[model samples]
Target: MLVLNGPDGKFVVDTFVAPAWPRLKEALDGLGNAPVKCVIDTHWHFDHTDNNTRLHAAGATVLAHENTKKRMSEPHDLPVLYRGTDGALAGLHFDPSPVEALPQQTFFDTCKLQANGESLVLQHVAPAHTDTDIHVHFENANVIQMGDLFFNWMYPYIDPSTGGKITGMIAAANKILSLAGNDTKIVAGHGPLGNKADLMEFRDMLVTSCDRVERLKSAGKSAQEVVAEKPFADLDPIWGNGIINSEQWVQVVYLTL
Candidate 1:
């Protein structure tokens, strides 16, 4: 969803859904024919990789974490996408991505790249939102693009199916906070642009939620029972406004704990 105009050609970071491809293409075209030289997928999520094939066909090399390519090459079922008639969440299935859409290059731990007159530092975090989560730090610009590790003010979708851990989420936030400065621009995978303060609040929220959920689970409470208690009722006004409600967030936190 971000484009960087390098001195030679352009570089892109993440992408939108398939329906928005033309607009993305137009945006690239408007840059006076500087072909997209590279595309980076922060994770393997479909929302971030949907336009990979198109960009690849346009002569861009796709890059991502090694696990991202592995995840994309297999089928996945996410239960958060839909609610069933039985009042339970139904699975939203994703088939393996086509070979053309898979990343052509991948790194394991960390890597650095220079583009658009900026030094980009790419670092992969431990499993938080998903196993493939990574962050791109534009050192010169003082901007950090975190795929799903920091959700700004919204409650995040923690995919337990893909090695997401609440503790890992907390650690990721702490790591970013350590790297960010007062004036740094923190780009989240969801919600509005954030700052160190916003990320601090988010990290605090996750800590509080994790503590409460862990306590309830330790007391032998069921996940549904924890949801019924609405431990996050006080914090719901901000984080709960997203697709995940307080009740649902409680469930998610419980599972991860």
Candidate 2:
């Protein structure tokens, strides 16, 4: 999550889960004691949007991409996300968010804003991680917040249920690379902070995985067959140490293809 002290009040980029609000509130209060004027949702994922109600109740208007509020208004079951305690491919069931937590203002394409004495540019990408993905670019500061598009050193989970595409993921990275310079700071949705070189490396990893998975898929190999072959064994030690293992990563890539 990012905080920008605006001319009027504070501008928060995203939020943590509801349980983290007290610590979040303390952090906000510690930063100049400014009221939150607005909160931005990078995407509709619960991890990024669970605390909207608290901040909204505090009188902050929420801003997000057009699809964010829509997605939040519906229920979702993502079996690819996890398995139940039974150890089968069952997903967590999500209920619709309360009306108070919904975004009040949304933009279709690109929106520009002036906050913290800096110009912020928000742009939508084509369904990379999820259909609601948007990146916030702080132009003057040369910093970019890639909502879930860049996963840093780990293999990213592509959400096929919401139109996530490996090709779109590649395109989104190129978009950021085009807008970024060698000195630019790239804040990823997960993992440590990154830069242009780090982003480039991550993009290359995506390309290699996509290409390998596509080849197997084209050769009439099932996702499980590809997983059994362990095509990504070499890349796993470096990139598969995250929440997703190599086998699961192969299935995810294949599904996107």
Q: What is the C-alpha lDDT of each candidate?
A: 0.88, 0.88
The true-structure Cα RMSD of candidate 1 reads: 1.9
Tens digits of per-residue lDDT, candidate 1, 1-257, equal 67778566888889768998988888888987788999999898888899999999989999999999999999998766323233444257999999999999999999899876889999999999999999999999999999888888989888888888989999999999999999999999888999999999999999999999999999999887777787998999989887677777787788777
User: lDDT score, residue 88, model 2?
Assistant: 33
Q: Candidate 1 — which residues are off by over 4 angstroms?
A: 80-90
- Which regions of candidate 2 fall more than 4 Å away from where they truly are? 81-90
Pairs clashing within candidate 2: none
Steric clashes per prediction? 1, 0
Pairs clashing in candidate 1? Answer: 1-14
